[model samples]
Target: MDIRIGIKDSAREIAFDSAQSPKEVEEAVVAALDSGHLTLDDAKGRRYIVPSAGIAYVEIGSESTRKIGFVA
Candidate 1:
């Protein structure tokens, strides 16, 4: 799934593809908002941690099946 995180006062948003399910992502965001920060791992294994206070908006894109190779 494609996730876009908007930071407060920032022009560009942090975006990445996560291997996590929608429910898991939602849980993480909710926990972060209540706890302190948001943390999620991308499909590449890189982990992202952002302060919840600095989060402007969170855009969760619809999950789509990845296409492989060319089609006729």
Candidate 2:
């Protein structure tokens, strides 16, 4: 799944791909916001952490299969 995190005062948002489910991601975000910190592990084993207060919003993209080549 593709996740986009909007940071306060930043023009560019953080984007990453995670293997976790949408519900799990949402829960984690909510938990982090409530606790003042957000941490997430991506499918590639990379960790992302940010202050919940600094987060403007979180956009969760739908999981889609990668397509190659052009289709008529």
Candidate 3:
């Protein structure tokens, strides 16, 4: 799975194998959810909070972007 992480006011791409054990990923996701720094309604609702970064936001797969063959 490809995921984006926010680091020091910037976003970076991360890759995780979908076939790996789900435990670590699940734990990370849960921790992120509990952090409360990620608001589901920020930047028109495309951002989430990560422990290492203040905010993790994505602008991928939008209608216009998709039409132009861009994948985020």
Candidate 4:
């Protein structure tokens, strides 16, 4: 899954790939909001923690399904 995190007052967004399911991600986001900090792990095992107050938006992409050729 691809996740993009937008920070307040920043033009560049933080993007990473993870293996977490949609439900898991949603739970994490909620937990972060309550705890005041967001923590996430990438596919490569790198951990990212950001202050919840600095987060502008979170865009999560669902797991990609393989497709062949062009649309007809």
lDDT of 1 by residue, 1-72 (tens): 999999999999999999998889989999999999999999999999999999998888889997899988
Task: Rank the candidate models, highest lDDT first.
Answer: 1, 2, 4, 3
Maximum-lDDT candidate: 1
lDDT per residue (tens digit) for residues 1-72 in model 4? 999999999999999999788788888998999899999999999999999999999998989977899988
Q: 1-72, model 2: which lDDT tens digit per residue?
A: 999999999999999999999999999998997899999888899999999999999999898988999988
- lDDT against the true structure, each candidate: 0.95, 0.94, 0.40, 0.92
For candidate 4, report its TM-score.
0.88
Give per-residue CA lDDT, model 3, range 1-72, as digits (tens).
334444555546432223223354445555666675432223333444345445454322222222566669
Using lDDT as the yardstick, the better of models 2 and 3 is: 2
After TM-score superposition, the amount by which residue 45's alpha carbon in candidate 4 deviates from its true location, in angstroms, is 0.5
**lDDT measured at residue 35 in model 4 versus the true structure, 0 to 100:** 99
Please provide TM-scores, in order, for all candidate models, with all chains considered together.
0.89, 0.90, 0.27, 0.88
Task: Give one clash count per candidate, in the order shown.
Answer: 0, 0, 0, 0
- Report lDDT (Cα) of residue 36, candidate 2: 90
